[model samples]
Structure formats: C-alpha cells, structure tokens
Target: MTATTSDSTNAYSTPADDGASTASTASPAPVSPWPRRLACTLVVLVWPLIWVGGLVTTYDAGMSVPDWPGTYGYNLFLYPLSTWLLGPFDLFIEHGHRLLGAIVGFVAIGFLIAAWRGDQRRWVTVLAAGVLLAVIGQGVLGGMRVTMSARVLAMVHGCTGPLFFALCVVAACVTGRRWQRDRVLAAANHTQQGQITANPSTGLPADALRSPWMLWPTLLFGVAYLQILLGAQLRHALPTSSPSMFAHTAMTHVATGIFLWLLTWVAWSVMRGCGDLTLSRPAAALVCLVAVQLLLGMGTWIVNYGYPSILESLPGSASYRLASKNLLDAWIVTGHVATGSLILAVSTLLAVRLRRRRWVLTQLPH
Candidate 1:
C-alpha cells in the first residue's frame, strides 16, 4: 500500500516535474529579428516613396519621361545613370520617383518572404500577401496612369500611398519586440477583465483608457485618412482645376484639419491621464506632429497661393502669385506631404497598440 501511494504521487508530478512542465510550456518565444527588420525596412522605404511621389507632383514632372514602365524608351532599370543624373531637373525627380517606387516594391517582396518564414501567425502571412498585392497594384496603376494620360488614376494611386504606409506601419508594430513582450506579460499574468480592474501600479482605473484605446484612436485614424485624400485632391487638381472646386477642397481641408487636430488632442489627453507610457508617449507625439502639420498647411498655402486674399484688402495691396513656387516651395510642400504620411503611420501604430492591449487585457486567461 505504501509503495502504491508513493508511486501515485510520483506519477502526478513532483515540484521539479511541475517546473519542467511549466518551462517547456511557457518558455518565452524567441523574438524573430528578420520579421521585424523586414517590416521596418518596408516602413522606411515606403515613406521615402511618398516624398518622391510628392516631388514628382511638385515639379509637374509626372510626364517628363513620357514613357510607361520605361524611361525615354530605355528599359526602366537599364536607363543610363548619366542621362538620368544629368537630365533636366524635372525628369530627374519624375524618373527618380519611379525608381524609388520600384525599390519599395522589391523591399516589400523581401518583407513578404521574411514574414512567411518567421511570423507564425496565419493572419500575418495573409496581411503580408495583401501588402504584396497592393504594391503590385500600385505599380500597375502608376504605369497605366502615365500611359493612358489618366489624371484621375493618378489621384487614386496617390490616395492609396498613405493607406499602404499605414498598413506597413501597423505590421511593424505587431512584429515588434515590445508587442511580443506585452503578449507574454499578459499571458504570464493571465489578466481577466473583471479581476483587479486597475493597472499594475498606482491602482489607477484602467477602465478610463478602454474607450480611448478601443474607439477614439481608430476614429482619429479614419479622420486623418480622409484629410489625406482631400489634400491629395487639392494637390492633383492645382491651377488646372475649377476655381470653385479648388476653393471648396481648400476649405474642406482646413476644416477637416481642425477637426483632426481636436481628435488627436483629445486622444492624447486620455492616454496621458491613463498612466501608461506605451500609450501616452505615442499619443503625445501624434499631437505634436499634428500641430506641426497644421503649421505646414499654412506654409503650403503661403508658398502656393501667396498670402491670403484677405490681405489684399489692405491699402494699395492686391492678390498676386508668390514667386511662382521656387525650390523652397517644393521642399515645404513635400515636407508637408511626407509629414502627413508619418502622422498617418503613427496613428496606425497607436491604434494597433491600443487595440492589441485592450484585447490582451480583456481576453486574459480566466
């Protein structure tokens, strides 16, 4: 009887056995460097592509090369460096934008391969595939726009850029080390929704953050995206656009900009008061960037349209074009464009973090 009892207890698992079982089952996952690195590479490459596209628009150089999938009848990749480098400035920017876009596509392929090999999540693989498809579609649409002389297609292609940028950024956030670490922390704590209702430290009410993360950030992202599209319409429209249409878009851009600013500020306020640096810091950066973007909007107006027409009411003053958009104009406009993408990306990152964190909090093993 004594021997049977000892055998039964031993069969159940000694402390050491329990420790071994826990170690085997709960060992922290090895962080995959390639996936995160590839995602980051895509993010870096895509943003510059945005700037290059802006430059193409800035110089009215979209048709400088006058060829589709090629530069001046030469295969795009085979185009001579000497010709491109010494070419007229407009051709340089336009062709360079094409070349940069190709590079982004290639990097996207790399990211897809890396994610397939390293990210075990099936959804991640699907997302990478979607990104690849978007890149290919972007390339085709750009080529078609140039070949068909379709300005409307160009507007569509322009709008997709920011969305692609946001997608890449969100993927990077999900593949990041910190994101994985948070998952582990949540799993280790096995946090249940109703249990302990407060955050780890300070006993602060974490419920205060629920809506901020769950709903507000996402709403702000959509608003920013709409503003981007409106900005793109105004950009692609330019002097050739109907004056009334231009004025309406311009007014809409400013009005939406103010609305987006308020949304971001409110999000930041909620996050800052929530006492989570992970959420609060990004919220803070977002507000600052949005502020800078508003300022840049002003600069964009001054550079392109000159001082407001209202200023013409002054004594002996009249409305006039400002210096015909010099190189400074190009840089300021491109900076504004690039910053808008960055803001969009950052907003995406915030939304991903908040949504994931909320999921972690609510779905903790009960």
Candidate 2:
C-alpha cells in the first residue's frame, strides 16, 4: 500500500514537473507584425485620397452637386449610371473624392478590427477605433460642408485631414515592434546607475530622449503642419477675394518652405554629428520630400500663369493651353497635399521614437 501511494505521488509530481518544463519552453506567442504593417500601408494608401481631396478643394468643387450624401437626387452610389458614366469631369472629381472617402472609412474599420484582434497593446486598438470614428465624423463634416456651402466648414474639414493623418501615425508607432524595443531599451538604459546628463546648450537629456537626433525632426514636423495650414487658408481665400487676404500669406508659405528647407539642413547636420543611422535615414527622406515640394510649388505657379483660361481667348485664337484644367492638375495638387501629409507622418514618427528613448532614460532602473 505504501508502495502504491509513493507511485501515485510520483505520478502527480511528474505531471507537475512536466507542466513547469512546458511552461518554460513554450515562448510567449509571437506577436504578429501584420497589424503594424497594415496600419502603415493604410496610411500610405490614404495619401492619394488626400491629394485628390486637395485638388477638389483647390478647384472649389465642393458644391458641384449642391446636395449632401447624393450627387444630383440619387444616392452617391446609385446616382444615375448614365450621368456617372458620362458626367462632367468636375462631377467626376467631386464624386471620386466622395468614393475615396468611403474607401478610407472602410479601411479604417478594418484597421480597427485588426488592431483589436491582433495587437497585444490595448492603446493601439483604442487608437484604431478613434481613427475610424474620425473618418466617419470627417465624412459627415464633408457632407455638411457641401450642404451649407460654408467656407469655415470647408477650412475645418481641410484641417481635419492632417489631424487624421497624425492619428494614423500614432497608430503605426504603437503597433510597431521597433517602437516597443526602443521603449524597452530606453528604460533599461535610463535605470542604470549613472544617468547621462543632457547637453547644457541643446537641452537634450543625456540619455536617448534628448538626442538632438529627435528634437530637430519634431520641430520640422511642427513647421510643416503650420505651413500646410497656411497654404490651405491661402487657397481658401482665392475664391472669396477677401480684402483680409494678405498676399503675405503666400509669402508666409514661401517663408515656411524656406524654413523647412533650412530645417532639413539642420536635421542633416544633427544626423551627421550624432551618427545615428536611424535618424539620418528619415532626415534624408524629409529633405528629399521638401525638395520635391519646392519644385511642385514652382510648377503650380508656372502652370497657373502660363495657362490663361482658353475660354477667355477671343474666337479663333490659338489655344496654346495644354490639358491644364483636367485630372493632371488635380493630381499635381493632390501630390502637393500628400507630401505635406507625409511630412507630418514622418515628423510624428521621429517624435515617438524620441519619446520612447526618453521614457527609458527616465524610468529604467538606475
């Protein structure tokens, strides 16, 4: 009987030992990277819509239909197939923007679902939901702008695009393993016995957070966003011919562009000095985008000037105007807008990376 009791105890203990061994050997389930990649991909995909929307705005096509949620008495989708198929191009651009808006709405919904299901991080899921809500609200605001024909609403609607872009940026950061790794590294570094002191001149924390690497990029992003807002207001003022419109706004846009150019230079300097490849790569990208934006701005001005309205020409006059009024100009305008959105995205990413480094510096066990 004692032998039997010993055997049973040994059997129970063996299972217990096996359970412990299995627990140790079984690694935590690998976190899928798909959600993060999807979030980033979605952000990029939405840029075309941003560009298209900007074109629609610049052309003052907001009220082409003079109706909300419909394009001339039919639901947006059910609008007469004949009209949709053979509509004025203006109708097409305006309706196309609406359709892209709907697509973004659905994409945002999918992102929310993926984040909620696949991400271990709760904030990521919450942020995805928030973005979905923002897209929905923005859609409504768009409809309202069409209904009211209010310039103020239009401005608000335009401004919301960048904010939405920023939110997606945050979502991307939260979902990425690199961001988490940086956070962990920073924490570990900061908690070390000897905390690094910030450089007195630059006010950067000695550890990872205050790296001049982070500060300059964050500043560049802020300036870019302000520039975009200024540009939007200038475009908005064009149709109204408001005396309150300052030619200086255009000049301000130019100045901001210059500032952005210089900021890129500064970022490059910082990157070179710091020798951080991560920071340098993104800074280089920012510089390239800025260069492209400058060219686009100049091209837009040239196009506006060189192509006087052919319709304004006397009959039989040579119509030297290229296809300047069609989808191509719209696309150029959209690209300009999208570049601004990209700037905002990259800037926010740098800021988060810096923040994680800082968090580690501050919280890691010293």
In order, how many clashes per candidate? Answer: 0, 8
Candidate 1 off by > 4 Å: 1-31, 181-203, 211-214, 238-242, 312-320
Q: What does candidate 2's lDDT look like per residue over 94-180, in tens digits?
A: 898898888888788888888778765565677888989999988998999989888888888887888788778877776765554
TM of each candidate vs. truth: 0.84, 0.76
Q: How far is each candidate from the true structure, as Cα RMSD in Å?
A: 7.8, 10.5
Clash pairs (backbone) in predicted model 1: none
lDDT of 2: 0.68
Whose TM-score is greatest here?
Answer: 1
Residue 123 CA error for candidate 1 (Å)?
A: 1.4
| Cα TM-score of candidate 1 | 0.84
Superposed by TM-score, candidate 1 places the C-alpha of residue 155 at a distance from the truth, in angstroms, of: 0.8
lDDT of 1 at 219: 89
* lDDT for position 293 in model 2: 88
lDDT of 2 at 46: 70
Off by over 4 Å in 2: 1-26, 30-34, 80-82, 182-214, 238-244, 305-330, 361-366
